[model samples]
Target: MKKTQSCPPPVRRAALYIRVSTEEQAKKGYSIPAQREDLEEYARTNGYAVAGVFVDEGKSARKRYTARSAFMEMLEKVKAGEIDVILFIKLDRWFRNIADYYEVQKILDAHNVAWKTTQEHYDTETTNGRLYINIRLSVAQDESDRDSDRIKFVFQNKVSRGEAIFGNPPLGLKVEDKHIVPDPETAPLVRELFRHYESHRSISRAVREVGEQFGRILWLDGTRRMLANPLYKGVYRDNLTYCEPLIPPEEFDRVQELLKERSIRHNQTGRIYLFSGLLVCSECGRKMAGRYATTKRKAHNWEYHLYRCPTAMQYHRCPHRKEVNEEKLEAWLLEHIQEELNAYQMQWEASASAPVRPKVDKAAILRKLEKLKQLYIDDYITLEEYQTDYQKYRGKLDAEQPKPQRPDFDRLRTCLNAEFQTGYTAMSPIQRRDFWHSIIKEIRLNTENSPQILFRV
Candidate 1:
């Protein structure tokens, strides 16, 4: 009698995965209901029990694998041996990128978890099937890239013609017949913004005053944007009038110059920091935010100020654990800054007699324009090519022309020295903040090295 061999039991548990990119949400056959119905029928016929169902809606597969919340949860369950196989509608539905597919394939292989598509014949059980899946993924990724490029080209052409392709105009403007126009109610607020900023020459003060009058807390950034934005002058990013004017162009230009003159460095916040947004963790490169702590002791209660990174505060997962003692750090910074400033002042005195160089690179641009003309004269290019190249160089030359420089060093040095002479800590918080902003460009902190204070050149 011949010995009979018993067959191994078939795998029964399965995890169903369905995904729909934002662009495909309206398409037929990509609907969640259709996918669920097809996948369930396939699972029933294959003698596999539905262990779990994962769906990622309006999510792009082009993003990192970990970004898909449902997919990640399914992967975790697969690794734990709760599911024997993963079933999807198609390989492209799983991933368009080949690199991401392989990374996931390696994980599935290690855990002995097989993956298959209900609609496609490619299987992970054989070598040829795996190769076929890779080829299909490569084609999918190429198509995705081409689609992205087409969308970008269309957007750029629309913007070049000064057409508002995007929906909704920013705060003070409204879309009227596909054109950007000022909102009657909000337009007055925008005009008031410029007038208030021009008078005060302070972003924080303007925000506070305007916010109080309007019965809302106006943001500092919004006020600054209103002052600097060319939209108030009826212009867009390309510096041409694409919308109706709110403030006169002359008034807008004057406000910009005034803003530059009043900039106490880039420090716009009313919140005072002794190190002035300079403290950063060397290990993680995150800024160390200033914080105060109170600890109760047996003898006496203690109050301490500290500068700590997001990692130490449980906001980030970085490994750097060091916290800066605010009092000690501030003392060190003030002393070092004073010494650096004295040396910088001496260097400035030495260079006072030196000749000033032209700020704009006019000569270089003019030379390029001459060379471009020679190319056209020598018939090296067609009339259309010459005209296109000529316009490109001309635009560069126009941009290279000199503009006014601000926060005049002469004025800054005079103001800073007068304030410093009165004693560093003696000045009011705002005055001290302004003084530091004028002199110190940045301050970097490290647990291993001394605090590094970079002064304005």
Candidate 2:
């Protein structure tokens, strides 16, 4: 029998992995060098050549395995059977995900490479050794999942209570130990903007003109669009969630009314509405009471009522005691309303992912997207959106490509659309909640004297 030369001195090519998430990086004992030294010394003492020590300093293991560059490359090597063992200070240091940790171990094991955590004193080659690592990874992963869930739970609780999280506080705030404190500087600007906007129904030039008064201001059209963001009023939202407005219906209706009238040329001070605030006295600025006078019309053969300034009749010296006839003003206002509403550019939807025909599993699509998200925190969707809509279109083209004997396009789309409609209807209650969370865009009420339509970023 061949002795097999003691299995070529156990091959002994080792890969060392060290990681410190954002929290661990802030702490002292969890230093990278200390872990690296301990891991490297353990490898050397165990007759293993340190092929390379993988150091993923300041990376989150809550993310998938491939996110850490060194660890990813190390996995590729492990799969190639280039390393005898993958070493870590402990199981969590290796991977906080059992799915990823054991998955990689299986790849290593299949390629005749063994994974050994020095501190744990286990090797994957034996069944008893595998059991120790199974428990270790499972516990580590459970803790990691729990920690992530706990953080998310805290954030959700804050949101449910209408608290701000992790952003520049709305125009009225300054950060105070993770809470929003009203800022004397920015608060007044916000108030004035809201006041003027509510009165005028103009957001086009208003945002730019108002922001220019400040030393530092956000002039981006997108940021300008946020002027009407309800989150500033303290709200939280998530995707497709629904919640009734906390504000009075009248106040909310008033804001909505303002958004409808905004236009690009609205800020020009050429015309003013005399009818505003029930027609004030030209001299005293007191609100004039409304009165109706019936008149006989000639050619059209009609009776008409007109509103006159009551204060004018009350005071004899008033020069502006004019009664504006209804027909003309009604026509004028209708024209204005028509013009404003018609002035809206067509709302073009960038193709709904170029139609994911036949394989109409929206759930699968969402799951795949989630997986992609786990692989990369930021996705091609955003990058594609930023780089070129054409790139997204091209991606849609790929997604839209027809496969042989796939489901009928129309039928699949119908089914999917029906499901989406059902979901949308169901989501109405939570829409308000989701709106606060996912939508970073501002929904400005067009402060122009137009109808109540909203402008969104």
Q: What is the C-alpha lDDT of each candidate?
A: 0.72, 0.54
RMSD of each: 10.4, 23.8
Model 2 residue runs over 4 Å out of place are 1-12, 25-28, 77-84, 145-172, 176-178, 187-213, 217-230, 237-457
Residue-pair clashes, model 1? 0
Tens digits of per-residue lDDT, candidate 2, 1-457, equal 8665543645578888888876886774767888888988897687888898788888987688878898888878877768877788766777777778767766776787766666666656579877877887788777877677558746754654445577775556666655555577777676666655554445644576667766546554654455556644544454212222333334444455445423212215332232323333444444444334444567545444354445466765555566555445435533443233233212222233345466445455445544443433344454333335433433553465444332223432332342444454455422422322121112111112122322221
User: Candidate 2's error at 143, in angstroms?
Assistant: 3.6
| Highest-lDDT candidate | 1
Q: In lDDT terms, how accurate is model 1?
A: 0.72
Model 1 misplacement above 4 A: 1-11, 187-212, 216-401, 405-457
* Residue lDDT tens for model 1, 304-348: 667777875786576556777867865665556556556666666
Clashing pairs in 1: none
Question: Residue 344 lDDT in model 1?
Answer: 61
